[model samples]
Target: MRIKDLFLLLLLFSSLLVNAQQKEIDSLENYYHYSQDAKRMEICLELSALYRNIDPSKGLEFAKEGITLARHFKDLKTEAAILNEMGVLYRKLGELDKAMLYHKDALVIFKSTNDIMGQAYCFSNIASVNIDMGYYEMALEYANRSLELKKKLGDENQIAYSLRIIASIYHESGRYSEALPYYNQAMDYYERLNNKTEKANVMLNKAIASSSLHDDFTPEIVDSLFSQAQIIYERVGSKYGVAAVHFHRADWEVRVENYTAAEQYYLKVLEITKEIDAKVLYLKALEKISEFYEIIGRNQTAYDYLSEYVRLQKELFSESKAKEVASIESRILLREQEQEIDVLEAQQKTRNVIIVMIFVLLIAIVLFLLFFNQRYKEIKRLNNKLNDEVTHRRKSEEKLKESEEQLKVLIEDKNRFLSIISHDLRSPFSGMYGLIYLMEEQYDELSDEKIKEIIDRLSKSSSQINELLEDLLSWANLSSGNIVFKPEIFNATKLINEVVDINTYRLQTKDISCRYDSSTQFIRADYFMVKTVFMNLLTNAIKFSDSNSQIEIEREIIDDRIVFSIIDHGIGMNEDALKKIQQPGKHVSKSGTMGEKGSGVGLLLVYDLLKKHGSQPEFSSSPGEGTTVKFSLPVK
Candidate 1:
């Protein structure tokens, strides 16, 4: 049979398996109420997961019921687990605030109950959400906390998961050097656990990191890594994993300029996503394909794919919200029934006490009345005191939370400054020192040509160092709220040309050309800040480009704003670099295409300056293809 036919057969089998699982769930539901408390909670959790992808409403219903039962039994451990599940559900629905709230709440309960394992899981969940929010600092912090706790617990699978999260955070920050050890550690643990699924995931992650570190690993090793992951995923019948493997492979193919293989792999990803009914992955594949088409200059096809992606993404969000509403209503109704039962039980207990009192009333009615009056007053006094204590405790908790948040901000600032000192300042100065020392040693024997070359290199390094110092000062001034934004009307074309003129020498030195296509659009913004944005972007284009490659700078009026872009067909960046470049104070420098040097802090300054003018920068790149960085400013 053909590959397509085989896929259809496998899909049919998977559907049948799903149906059988549903039947088992139905059987469990029929006898659910008869089961013991512990068994019931287990069953509910199982049913929730089984239904999670099939019907989100049913999944949430089961999860909500499980949470309610866990709380009623005072099962804090189980409740924390269920809350984490609820957070995951909310995250899937794109309700980030609700997801964060639930995870934080779970963390608090876990800490209070001293459930170390639950606390680790809470940390992991928080880290994942923070990663999604692009809060790399917090993500790293939480991932490390989770890893530490898991280490103490000594569970291989849990430890592996924690390690993976930490690796992921490091990788996301473009710190692949820091990430590799964690990846290797996680791989070993997963192998010891014999967890094929997680092993496959780790392999894929390792390959992605390898892609970013061009000098550390060979292309063959990376390809082999991807292949191993693909085999494991396929063997385990993990459609999601298989799709992920394909996507990564596609990315690698693009990097190697194997356009045909990349296109085929991308299509395969879409096919697998569709077969597995994975909407999010399907959407992601569509977007990647759209970008691929754009790369190949098929604008119409790219737009068509993008349009479909946007439509499906919106639909998915709407569907998630609607299901959430239905599940919430179901949960509320179920809780009401539980509450009614509790009320009835309480009423019965009260009646029994009254009857017992009546039976003893004839013997000591007067004595009992005097004692009851005193007891009532005493109970009321204690209740008042308890309420006051609860209020005070709550206030203390709020203050503690505020303090924790402030501490996080402070730590982030310190780390940023430390990065500046450690890398930005040290790297250039260290190079200058070494070069000066070498020149002094070779002064008598060196030829004039060699001396002139060294001087030129030294000049270039000095310029880079000077640029870094200036950017650092600008950033410091901005952070201190001392840099004033003076908005004025300026021609976008004129400003771009000026920036190009300023960087003309850098471009000519590399035998590169700069071209601009801009209308006579005007924008009201801080002129110097805008100019700096263009300068940094243009310089970056020049830095990353190979000799003789052309840079395209364009400005267009889009929706009453001037959209400016600097395009370079040079050594492109990976996703990690893109993420790191966008993050404030977290940028890391890499050597340019022609051994050009940089301080890596320019983008950070540019980002802050753009935000100062109410604009957001955007980046798009694939390795070897090129990069496009753009932002829009309001028209005057």
Candidate 2:
């Protein structure tokens, strides 16, 4: 094709891309107006991400709306997700500090909710912002953390993205050799995933790094890589990506001493950045073009470009500083609101106490009047039937004594239940609080290993607290007869696999393997209840099982019932423990082989759920032998 024809085609393609994106945005906006509650919030979040690269200001507007809706709906996960997206938008707009603040806030929410994948993405985003701010060490640290989490999640695409970020950090710090291997790894992953956009991105980065290693990659090889990346970027309609390719191409040309070609590439970069309204890229182009002019001895032209670059830089810095100040003011406002809420709560409590006192005083006065009237009646009756009144009083005293004894029993039971709950819940929370306090007071003084250790402990405590709350809620619902048993036919095998999958981290931690037959088996039971039962049992087995041990899950058909068994090789129960387990109301749990603690309500929940299914859990164990727990459900 002729050069003019190619240029016309590129312009046409860019127009079509913009039109398509605008149509999508219009459709979403229409739907958003009609949508209500959670769906509207979801659309808002989607729109925010959609507009991020194209129009950051619009993206921030949608993100803020999403955050408001998420908070209103008490959806912490979605709120954190929108906060992270806002951070990305801010980063794109060159507000690095504000971006970091948003990401850190999102990270805190993700951690509190135990959203591992959300936390991983936030780390990656924070790393990107740090890179832009020239904090390479901090960037590398967060990037590695993100990479570790992505690997744990087993998400190939996310892992590749993390790898790419880490590579960029190295490349920015001038460690070209270290960056190359990571870029290659990321490229390989993207190639396998068939993600053309990311693959092209990595190709561009690899080319830049390879340009520094002329001994390994020839100039021709580097040029080919850049050509490949440009083609892909154009095909994908990535305007910013295309601009990046042009900017880097200019750098490669300058490196090869091709001043004329380099100047053309730099001008092309300037045109693309302006067309896309990418301020960051535009600033970079202006700086580079000024340098290029100086290199060619065009002092007057260089001064003009240099002056423009300085002005633009100052404007961006001023905008970023303004955003930082706004963020600080917003935080101060939030703090003030919280303090006002605390004061209101205190006033409300005082009013409640005063109201209660007034109610008690009124009751006391009424009782006094009733007592005076009763005494007057008693005085009149005493003359007529003193013996009859004495006999009635004796019987009444005996009945009152009996009622008091019953009330005492009820109070003791209530106290015992409350004690059990408070002890289990408070222990974990106190440990978590102590760790947090230590970190808050001495974070700067702590070594990395010590911080990691504290984090691990905090995670465990949080997990323990979460488990306790879940079990408590389940037990409360079961005891109150609020949990309805809705039976349905479902694949029992699939349920077992899901339960196992959720406990993967635990299984990996203990180095325990689970063995179950892959067979299609349907059973009639409450799907959620049965899932809960399986989860609790499997978790118990994992906790008890020694490292490198295997837990076997088996299902066999016996008559009309499907018998499911979980057998674990670990410390078995003694006679006392067995007796305790047999008691339906008793919460029977012990420290596991690895000294893992539990709220002891899990087994009670399991037993209650099994009973609702018209089945009982049978246990077989010896003091030194491993335990086997089996239950049956109706096969449909």
Per-model TM values vs. the true structure: 0.42, 0.40
Q: How do the residues 1-636 of candidate 2 rate in per-residue lDDT, one tens digit apiece?
A: 122222232333344366678889999999998999899999999998888756776677778789989999999999999999999988976678889999999999999999999999999999988887889999999999999999999999999989978887787677888998899999899989989987987897788788877567688888898899999999988877788778888977887789999999999988988897777678878877887887888968877776677567657755754664444333333334444456476833322322333343344345434644573463333233334435544654574566457545444434544665678877887888899999999999999999999999998888887898798767655653457889999999898889999999999989999999978899999999999999999999898888889999988899999999999988888887877787765766578888899877888788889999998788887775788999999999
Error of 1 at 373 (Å): 69
Error of 2 at 149 (Å): 1.9
Candidate 1 local lDDT, 257-363, one digit each (tens) = 89999999999999998997877668878877887887888878877776677568557755754665455444334444444466477833322322332233222
Q: List the residue pairs that clash in candidate 1.
A: none
Q: Please report the candidate that would top lDDT against the real structure.
A: 2
What's the true lDDT of residue 370 in model 1?
55
Q: What's the lDDT for all of these models?
A: 0.76, 0.79
